[model samples]
Target: MNQDIIKSQWKQLKGEVKQKWARLTDDDLTLIEGKRDVLEGKIQERYGLARDKAEAEVRDFEQRLRKH
Candidate 1:
């Protein structure tokens, strides 16, 4: 999914995101606020993933969303 699309659909997507990355806190979600970069950074911080891995995971997530 495009970044703009993600941002626009963020409210609807937040539940799915929480399901996918349960480690993330409510505060994290609020901080992310539809920014892909912030989402990636939070995922990396919470999961101890490298930047590339985080980016890949988010990309895969967006692809899956597209399929649905």
Candidate 2:
């Protein structure tokens, strides 16, 4: 999905995000607030992933969301 769609639909997507990234806290989600960069950073920090890996994971997640 596009950034605009994700931003507008952030509330709805929050639960799914939490489910997918169990290590993330509610605080992290709130901070993310549908910003792709923030989400990528949080994933990188929480999962101990490299920047490229974190970005790829987020891209994959976005693609998955689009598929649904």
Candidate 2, clashing residue pairs? none
User: RMSD per prediction, one decimal?
Assistant: 0.5, 0.6
After superposition, the stretches of candidate 2 with alpha carbons farther than 4 Å from their true spots are none
| Candidate 1, backbone clash total | 0
Pairs of residues clashing in candidate 1? none
Poorly placed runs, candidate 1 (over 4 Å): none
The CA lDDT at 28 in model 1 is: 95
lDDT string, candidate 1, 1-68, tens digits: 77889889999999999999999999999899899999999999999999999999999999999999
Per-model TM-score versus the true fold:
0.97, 0.96
Q: Each candidate's lDDT (Cα)? A: 0.95, 0.94
